[model samples]
Target chain A: MLEYQDYILTEFNIVLLSSIAILIFLIVLLIFEASKIRSKFGMEEEDIEHRLDLLRHLVGAGKAYLFIADKEGAVVDINPDIQSLMGLEPNQLYGKDLGIFTEDTPGSNVESLWQVLRDKKLPFHLQLRGAWKNGEEFMETAEIRPLLAENSIVGFVVSRIGSTDGEGQSAEGSEELEKAYAKEQVIVESIGDGVIVTDAVADIVMMNKAAREILDTQESEIGKSIYEILQLEDENSAMLLPQYHPLAEALEDERRVMSRSYYIVRNDFTRISLAVTASPVIVDDGIVGGVIVFRDITKEKDIDRAKTEFVSLASHQLRTPLTTISWYTELLSGAGSDNLTDEQRNYLDVIYDGNQRMIGLVNALLNVSRLELGTFIIEPEPTKVQDLIMSVLRDVQPSVEEKQHEIAFNSEEEMPEINLDPRLMRMIIQNLLTNAIKYTPDKGKITIDLSRHYPDLILKVSDNGFGIPINQQDRIFTKLFRADNVLSKNTEGTGLGLYIVKSVLDRAGGNIWFESEEGKGTTFYVTIPLEGMKAKSGTKTLS
Target chain B: MMPKILVVEDMEAIRQAITAALAKAGYNVLQAKDGAEGLEIAFLEHPELILVDIIMPEVDGIEMVKRLRDDDWGKTASVMMLTNVEDSDKIVAVQKYHVYDYLVKSNWELDDVVEHIKNKLKAATEENS
Candidate 1:
């Protein structure tokens, strides 16, 4: 009996000890799991802090002004960029209503900007008047965009500011801009020229007051194409392609183009000679639009016609007298016999020389008239510069020898044959050489140099002569404008030589420039583009 | 015998100078105060050539030419235009009337006008022959 009782007690003790060990193991496992969960939560908190820091830096560095607003549209936080743009510090603007900047804005502009933000649109422009802390008001063009997160509106607004003078001002603040616009309007209205602007698509976008007045159209014609607006006859109108239109051509060629003369009749049944020039408005690397400026040149044309008539009549009338002088001089010389003394012969020679001089002057006058009337047709053929220069040299040789002046001609080896009008070229060179001889002091040196500048042939005439005064340079090429100095020294000059030279050069797409000091000397450079003579054929048709 | 020619001009210096030159050139010259007198004399005497100035009182050179073209005396005699106005429109008008030649006063010498007259007379004689 005593042995049985002891075994039962021991078994109970073993069972109690095993149950306690199991409870201890389960508690240790629970502690390990709880520790792992706490560590994971800590890591998640750290990740969120890092992400927020990155976002804050990004907002601060960005150029577009950034601000955070509560759901009620109260400003929560403002970035430095926004603070500077609004001319306010961060603390001063924090928690202020976002509507503060919009207070002076037009109601429609404010409403539209707000609506765009609320609708979560990408961005929109806002015209607003904003005041600085110093009580100064400014016009501002701003772009407002909403900050979206997780496909829902976040607590932020992003605004970018542009010029404060263009579109942002209230009616009062816009007075300056309005005044400028009015001044431009007045200038455009008062001008006699017609001005038209077209978009890249060649549709009329803007027309100045003169253009509208000239076209004799009402406001209803604003959105029409140029062709429609002008009501041009198909046959008379220039053939314009999408790329060949003056504006478009300017864009493609990167140069301005002048159209041929066209006729425009006014409402009063007055005819006008119209000339058009189209130039492109190039921005950055592309063409945005083009402007066409036109003017009426009828008065100029009439004057030109009158001048042409005078020249034609003058030439014919002068020729008859010249012929008489020539015949009488020949008769007098032929009538010479034993009775003719040396004094008589000398007197006749003086008369003959004076007659020749008059003839030369008349010829120069006729040449000038032809050039001004655009009737001086240059028929270009293969010609040698050397030969042309030599002929000019021969013609002016007598004057050169009479003045005891020396002329030197220098030409490049292998000088390319140039295409030019021999008659015109002769006239040009002869006039220049004659002027040099006439103006130079006795024993002065004159040099004619011909060289090929790539794409052009250059003729330079340098003379140690009575140089043109610097103050009188501008009038040198004006018809009948002899330099004061030249006029004082010489009374026989018609003052038409340089004028004709300039006109001929202009028509041939050539250029002339001279450098002179009153006493030193003068060098005149003439550049004749090789391709320009070819282009002159088109000018001939204008006559 | 020198052929009779009428000189009509507005400028006194030019008219006197022209008369002197023609007389020296051995022509029997008649002088008129203006285009009207010139026209009257032209009809009465039927001079070989009537020298007319363009701008004048009562009748201008162009009007005189137009009247001569319309008259019987005009067909038998020749008319020449002498003027200082050398405009294209004037020339066109002169051409329309088949005036012998248009002369600019500033550009012409006294001898030129005398020679032109002589040429016209010679041509008329040839046509008659």
Candidate 2:
């Protein structure tokens, strides 16, 4: 029986050896098949490393932070930028749930990402705050997208910082942005001055509200040439243009340019005097566009013309009377009165004196009119100040003597020759002296002081007579304004003498002011620049 | 003998001064206060020349000149318009009346008035001759 048992054992050992060898061979075959399948379908270690390197470089260059989540909403992979963005190490985030990376409730972005993948819709953007491992937070504009496999959703999220994607946020932010853009457009359109913008090729790019009003058109002028838009008036008709258009010239020079008196007619048939300034708009080292600003000055031009006409008329009309007065007075003092008695002769003398006074008054009125019209042409030349003063003294001598007044003329030193218009200078001095004599009481004393106040010629005319009231001093230089004191003292004055004096001084680049107290005295000081200055032609009348 | 002259002006001072100057010049002067009175005198005496002021209360000088122009009896009597307002419109209005001459009051000397009247009378005599 023992021998039979041993034989069974030996048989069992042999069967076990055979089974073990078969199992070992099957295991080696399965290992080879698995490696072949891995080579065919799965990524090799080297290939996977290369793909990860590419992804790192892509995330570094792109403005996006990339991440991957598993089906369980757990973070499986992340780029280097994700670490910097969320302040987390890759190891710390790898096994952690993606909900921990966001301050929002868990599974929100994940659920949306899965929903998009399941629905197979277009990608959508979301704004959320991302939390760092250290508990710091930052705003992220995230585009959560689903990775699809055989039409089933995987997990992926792309986030960028501080991007304006025009997406989900409070309505106020979007509305405010839209309003800012619209307001910019309105401001560009509502300005009164004409604004024209052109591209580098001198093609009209943009035109503002006033530009279209000036150009008299409603159609969009973009892409048209500037010369087509700006139709300049005829050159012979007080309008001019260069060989090239203003915008084209500005573009060529790459600088600002101006055009003088470029007339443009509006749709209402009114002509406008357009002064145009064109400037180049440069960007990125090249000319991108140009802009032109235009202003209308037609009213100013009309006023100028009217002023010239008024001056000529006033000068001729006033001069005619002056000529008559002069000729008749000379005739009366000569042989015409030879047969008259002493009383008759004396009467003639009074008439002659009256005529002379009328001439003086008329002359003063003419000066005031001319000065107000800005047509008083000041032809400045080298003149002796003393000579002008003497002439003024001679002119006012009759009035001075009629009041039985004495005038004291004083000059500390010989005044240097100054440049001034002789006629205008005479008018200024005479008006000042006349004001002094007219406002002074009978037998009053007048003093004329002339001195050099460095770079200026100063003249002071003072009178020991009724002075201007303090309250009315501010308006003494105004046209046709006479102080109450002067009016009470003398009612015949036209009250235009000091106005004429002020205007003449202003034209000569000089200034005049006075100091006075009632019942004391009045003193007027005039300071004039020692230079040749021409009077501006054509002033506007203000009522 | 000096030719007869008439002075017409609205202002008393201006008229008196002109009449005195004309009398001193040795002329037989007929004085009137306004254009209507001057026209009446012109028809009655048929003065050699008449000086009239333009701006007056009754029958302004321009109208007086027009009436005198229409009168056949005073056709030879010369008429002149004198005024202080020298606007172009007024000058044009006076020109329409065929007035012999217009003078601004501030511009006319007594001698100028006398000389102008003398020239007009001398021309009339020359035309008759």
- Cα lDDT listed for each candidate: 0.68, 0.69
DockQ (Cα-based) for each candidate: 0.06, 0.05
lDDT of 1 at B54: 84
**Candidate 2 chain B: 10-residue stretch with minimal lDDT:** B83-92
What tier of docking accuracy does candidate 2 attain? incorrect
Best DockQ among the predictions, by candidate number: 1
Residue range A327-351, candidate 1, lDDT tens digits: 4664565434356788988887888
Task: Tell how far residue A363 is off in model 1, in angstroms.
Answer: 1.7
Question: What residue runs in model 1 are displaced by over 4 Å at the alpha carbon?
Answer: A1-193, A197-203, A224-271, A275-293, A535-543, B1-129
Best by TM-score: 1
Residue-level lDDT of model 2, residues A305-383, one tens digit each, is: 5775675467545644554555555456655567778887787677776766665566556556555444345657788
Chain A, model 1: TM: 0.61
Which pairs of residues clash in candidate 1, taking residues 3 or more apart in a chain or in different chains?
none
> Across the candidates, what are chain A's individual TM-scores?
0.61, 0.50
